[model samples]
Target: MSYDDLMAMRPGVTFDARGEAQVLVWAPKAEKLQLQFGEEAKMLDMEPKDYGFWTLQTRALWPGDRYRFLLDGKGPYPDPATLYQPEGVHGPSEAFDLQEYEWSDRNWKNPSMKDYIIYELHTGTFTEEGTFAAVEAKLDHLVELGVNAIELMPVSQFAGDRNWGYDGVFPYSTQNSYGGPAMLQQLVDACHEKGIAVILDMVYNHLGPEGNTLGHFGHYFTDKYHTPWGDAINFDDAWSDAVRHYFVQNALMWFRDFHIDALRLDAVHAIKDFSPVHILQEIRQQVDALVRETGREHYLIVEMDLNDTRFVKPIEAGGYGMHAQWVDEFHHALRVSSGQERNGYYVDFDGVASLGKSFRDAYVFDGLYSDHRKRKFGIKADGIPGQQFIVFSQNHDHIGNRMLGERTSQLVSFEMQKLLAGTVFVSPFVPLLFMGEEWAEPNPFQYFVSHTEEELAEAVRKGRKSEFAAFHLEGEAPDPMAVSTFENSKLQWALIDQPPHGTMLQYYRQWIVLRKSQQLLRECDRNGLSVEVFGEKELLCIQRVWGRQHLVAFLNFSKSSQEVSLPFEHLSWHKLMASSDSAWNGPLEMPEQAEAGALTVAAESITVYANIINS
Candidate 1:
């Protein structure tokens, strides 16, 4: 609408007098814009501003009010800030009242940082139906497995039927096929009823390739900085305040309107802001205030590669005050210790000492010289509590971005997989289990996307092929848009009852149970955490302690049995709680006695011993 023509229309109903909610949309390109709320349309008068933003006020949109925006006096346009897209990503917005739905977890509160066992799952592929109801049925399973929280991959509306959701275009609207806004509420409501918290993964670094209309409405993107995806967001440029507000507002809406427990920010290293007060700090302050007002504890977790402890430290101590950060160093160290090839980032992490250092301080580099970047990188995360770091063996990035999307199941032996899980879960950090890792689903978690534009689709296909050329594979890279790509990635639930799958599932369940029952292992303290290297650089002994709870973790990375000596007395007489051996599905048949203060740890096996007995 022409800027002046949009200002000539007036609303039929008074909003502020009736205490109804109001909204203003800016669209300088349209000839005219009007509100299409059911049969009676309201004309909006746009207020002229320096940045060409159109303004208007409206009465509160109650539940079941179907609405759309009319541009240039033509047809209707989906709201740029739509909350629900019932018909899919291409449909009109539906007014959803948050108070209509009854919540069953009114008194339920989330577990503290020190008491979280996270389960990461992708909603689209988590179940056969790929809907909220399907995932809701599995809540009891997570609670049974002792996971306190569920971290879902980005659920924002993207352009395709299948995606990793890093390319989301609509930040406010929930994905349509995944059952939209109401379905998400139901899912969270069910989780809370089962004493499980929900943490949503959100991306603010870049928008999707298509269906992104923020640029057409106002100044959203700036050329001040550049990201690998495209132009960076204008956090410090002209009209950047509004752009920043758009994101923070969206974040608060998720917590306030939808009752989300927390939000996991994706790739914070790519976010650019050079203002006096960083955008992250601003977001932290606002969220903190919201928590105080609502009388509920909400968290903001960020995924960063900078290895700076300030991201997780408190604001009072001159830090960004985020609840936690995904610690990639732990993943890299475990992967290299398991004999993984030096791929892109793995080049900096191929030593047993690196693994030891990560276990000791939670970061392998710790400000040391890096061979990959040819510069010193990463600071020591010594004083930071282990709970502030979310550690995992494998995530979507590690599996899907690989040349063929080979999971840990395809690369390492069954024993090694269990050994790696033992190493991670027994650490002081908050442990996370990737979807299907419990049962070792054999299918590759390959990267897949569907582009609506033909040229963009071709570009994505060609780019994917070229990206994997360095791997020197023999076959053609599968088309990401093909139905087989999505179908091949689905979890084979029936596999859990098979041979190796059954063994892996039992190992995970048993380890999780031990992690819960063992007092020393449950305490997330760095003071008593120590590691003893053995097996001529192939074996490791990890010890963790909190108060009266003391645990010794034995791991042998090689394929042959080895004897690892302990530093403490009575260690020789320790009992085994978990083993990765295929033949010996349970613990060792022998007594819990050691020979001459030494323990016999099987090759590619992991065993945990509790020093303090139960009352």
Candidate 2:
């Protein structure tokens, strides 16, 4: 499709078939607007259109041309909707044709949500090269691990060479340090070729402080509703239609231009919009239309702190109609149950019972009193399917936000790590794994940023230290601006060839394969699951039944071995997998069959049993 047809002919730089370029920009504050093209510094006056949009037709622009907008005889600035910022965020934007690059996976279809085993990773830290090309080199490893989707952390252009990607300034442009837009397109194409979907995480709640020129051009943000990062985006105020369209168009461009299969919105709880049609709902509706037009399966996942099912509920039922959301209660419950140091939000969850509760019900804080917030938190998610909530034992925020940036491997024993993996993979909800989590890479996923401005860099360092003060952690917090910090976070890929790492990798592969093969394990029915906890013995039992198909898991959270009575004594069961099995290089041997009696579970181990007769 043509650029105009793909982007709905929005206001931006567009080239016509007659070899003329059309420049359209929204700059209501500028009484006069001029476009500077090429090395000759050729300037052209643009005519003012309705709704503060300026348009001009000129032969001075081409497909590979460079241009900038001059407002009221002022200095030149990059286009707000620039698709390619080859240089850093402050440099001039490059004009490029989206149709230049070719795609091979034209018939690529996204896997269903129930089959999504998302692997979340940062492009800068995932590989030694820290580029999109480098990530493509490792697609074979993800395919071997059996994850269907790869959820990339934010890749939008930030201020400098290094960042967590949450501090993006230009939402449309891919990070220049990570090989820019063309490289990102290549990565997406590679993922689809391997039958894997690419889910890009985006930050729309607030823009980064540095290199942000949106306010200079228009009222893109509002001081009325404040976010933790800064002022929230203007979504429900006067002249907010333009601000909302800017983001909505960005979302569409990712799918149409880059062919991204899914979008994982970062922290939608911070997005304060009280409009008649909420921004979340608006994006979903527009994306749904695009899915029909392109005949592709697209998903919208939001990272919302509030345990509100309204975000995932259908629009006909008065909700946002999103596909899924990142639910943290499972992580919190799992961490606490595994005997991690409790502080901050960890204080709210009870140990084994809470973990069992999270497995049965998606949220542990559903309409319950929260000691952390001193209020009744979360609404009841009774009818929501288990697949609508994405659960993980460890993620970027769960590990990187720690004072020392420790993974579950660093905090727990090897056996407990195996148990943690079993619990997450066997659960009904969609499971996500961090980049190096499969083989247990020892490197910590620390928060690191490289800012050119000294003042902004130091402010970030101080803020990092102060935020971790509540944990009362020992030693000093890592300096985020230091280059060594970023280097330390890189995954050691060679470790996978070693002893324990190789065994752990096989264990993860086994569990993921088991989840996909078993009918009861793959079922997304929330009401079909039951959880029984022996709080005194530190043992948790989960039974998932769909019709006559039964899959049961026994998890022993204690340090010592425990004997647990089988709840389903009437049925004959056969062992499917166990964390303590000899195949996993563990000392214990799994019994071939259990005949309705007491079973001894090893210390910090998880065992799965299936009914002998299938429905």
Candidate 3:
């Protein structure tokens, strides 16, 4: 059957106008299938259909009813497309009704991609409660910080109570530990009401090892290729069309039912597909159609290690046509330049020069050789807009994957932390901040999981130690199965009112306000930006222009104060913002303009100047 015909089959529970619900299962290997509702309910034999599908229609199934599929009359298993896993991954799936919630965001519209100031947070560690309702309670803090969008780490149902959510077995279920499907919908609805967009991170490359039953249902996995997690998803092998439809529908469900504004596709590079039409392209096409039908903007942001522009390039240009992608080069360059430990991937990057190149070109290794990979990597992202690339100084992978889970704040001084903020916020690309980055939260974002299987937990612990050994990191890595590890990662929200933390928080607020108010600072076009490096003096001069307004930012990465020449010596410049201002408790002395012929910038400081000369 064609792809469209297989997708039209709807291989899950669907309800009609008269409240009659239909339960469908796709088990090609099984000769008989039955639907078992509740513990004492009757077992109904599903009528077999074409293309390995079995269906059973009844008026008995209603919202909140628990059911399991009995394949070949052997035993029961949770639905592969389960909407809610209230009893955990091993138990029966709970039926959920999306239409029951009374949403108050009817007139809410998502902000355009260019205007996005993304704040990425893990729902579990973002607050003390670690639930969807708890995250909703903290929305006011994000709004006050001037962030228009919040990107959540994966929330799919995983093994136990605490996990990174990347090892989720059920793609459709909202984690039962995090208040289930209704709570997730409530969080999204609340965000829209506050003029904030919600972005969900999704894993489509491979499912987690535990609680996965798709292989028994159909040819959902293929042995042709292997992923780091497990067998590759069947996107091109026999009976792969149905598998593709399953994932595609999952992506649509987040937008259609939960009202998510965008989806951050996790590690698109691992998705192995050799078909005529790539899966990413197909997702983009469907998402575009959904946007047209709903009259609301939706985006697909990818997290890829390969610095290829094909993911975000236009479809007509022989690309997948994704909206944006996370650019790690910016983070790597910033980390190394700020005197962080150089190991593993950090070996390839040169300090300030590489950072300057990223400021100008958006990619440091654009079609260049890499000492770490032993091969040339990435394509030139010259003409692409800056909004298509999301950049950050710290993220989950950078901090959580470390042996000690130390944040950038722990690695650098308070003045340097403010400098990091200035550099990230002033850049042309869309900036993303980790949960506690703004206030320099002292908690480490360690890797933690709650795997039920003892053997699997030991394997994860061994894998983590071996992985960090390659980076030459000494000491033992934190135990991933411990509850303390997850608790230690939670943000200390009360610290925001403390002395230096409050000062830093206010600095971030001012920087974001400045970014929004300035036209040249918000320009996404690379042609309008330039970066000049003074390597010997550890200084960088970045200038961005939009029409008549020009913004020049001078950053000093040295330990001692440096006297640097302004980018525009002749034009009159006004001080826009400075990281070393006394208001932020820095040691530097702020001046109105250049003294003599150069501007005297304090050690590890950033100062921005603006000039509006119509020429």
On TM-score, the candidate that comes out on top is: 3
lDDT, candidate 3, 1-615, per-residue tens: 443565765557877767788776778878988888976866888888777877778988888899988888766888888989998888898877767788888898888787889999999999999999999999999999999999999998898999999999999999998899999999999999898999999999989888888788899999999989878999999988778888888888899888999999999999999888899999889889888898878899999998888889989998899999998999999988898878999999888999999998888998899999999988788778989989998999999988989998898999899988899988988989998999999899999999999999999999989999879978898899999999999999999999889999999999989878887777676788888898988788888888998888888888989877766556877888888989999887677665325778899999888888757
Candidate 2 lDDT, 1-615, residue by residue in tens: 333443355556766667677776768688898888788988888887666667787777887777888888886888887877777888888876666679999889888898889999999999999999999999999999999899999998888888999999888888998998889999999999998899999998988988888777778888889998888899988768778888898898899889998999999999989999999999999999999899988899999899898899999999999999998999999998899978988889998988988888889999999998899999888889888989999999999999878889899998999999899988989999999999988999999998889999999988998897777777788899888999999999999989899999999999889878887777777887888999988889988888777878999989988887655667888898889888887768879888777888898999988884444
TM-score of each: 0.91, 0.97, 0.98
lDDT of each: 0.77, 0.87, 0.88
Displacement of residue 218 (Cα, Å) in model 3 is 1.1
- Considering TM-score, which of the candidate structures 1 and 2 is the better prediction for this target? 2
Instruction: Indicate the worst ten consecutive residues by lDDT in candidate 1.
Output: 6-15
Q: Which model, 1 or 3, shows the larger TM-score? A: 3
Candidate 3 has what TM-score? 0.98
Candidate 1 residue lDDT tens string, 1-615:
453443332211213435464555655456566667764755454444434444555564545666777766755766667777676556666766555567777897988877788899888888888778889988877776778889999988887778888878878888888988888989998998898989999998888886776676666788889998889987888878667767777788788767888899999999988887777888889888888998878889999979898788888888888998898888988898898887667888865667788888888887899988789998888789878888999999899878678899999987788888888888888898988998888888888887788898888898888887655555777788887887788888888789878877777777778667766667788888888776374877887767765677777788777766655663343565657443436434434644336667677777766665344
lDDT of 3: 0.88
Ten contiguous residues with the weakest lDDT in model 2: 1-10
